[model samples]
Target: MKYFACFLPIISPEKSQQFRPQHLEYLEKGRNEGKIFANGKFADGSGGLVIYIAESSDEVVELARQDPYVSSGARGYEIHEWEMVTKAVIPK
Candidate 1:
């Protein structure tokens, strides 16, 4: 599997909030299935990011399309392959 970064720009903050529950559930499922590496929204509130583990861009795109935020039209998305040459350390 490879990493794909999904850029999700908020189209409607209201809609995003409306569907946030389902979207969180979807992310949780993906996490349990090992399809998602990490996901969160931008602090600036412009958008969100999801790192997915998949075979190809096409595969990731298909998976992303199922996100409640995308399916409910609360957000728009683009998929790109990500190369992780480094990791950030989170200090305790």
Candidate 2:
């Protein structure tokens, strides 16, 4: 599996509050399925970052596109392959 980082730009406060619950539920679903690694909102509220694990970048992108934030127009997303040093990464 490989890691991916999905970035979402600042969303309107109404949208953020409207979608936050479903968004977090989606993350929990991914976590249960072992597809999610980590996630967080920016301190400055610029956006959110979600980390995913998948076999290919395309898979990660597809997953990112499905996020409630993106699907509901609460946000748009950009995804890139990611790599972490040391023990944070599982052995391939």
What tens digits encode model 2's per-residue C-alpha lDDT throughout 1-92? Answer: 89888898965767877998999999999988999988899998889899899999889878987888888888878888888677555633
TM values, all candidates:
0.92, 0.88
Candidate 1 residue-wise lDDT, 38-80, digit = tens: 9999999999999999988898988999999999999999888
User: Which ten-residue region of model 2 has the weakest summed lDDT?
Assistant: 83-92
User: What's the C-alpha lDDT at position 59 in model 1?
Assistant: 88
Q: Highest TM-score: which candidate?
A: 1
Pairs with backbone N, CA or C atoms under 3 Å apart (clashes), candidate 1: none
Clashes per candidate (backbone, < 3 Å):
0, 0
lDDT of each: 0.93, 0.86
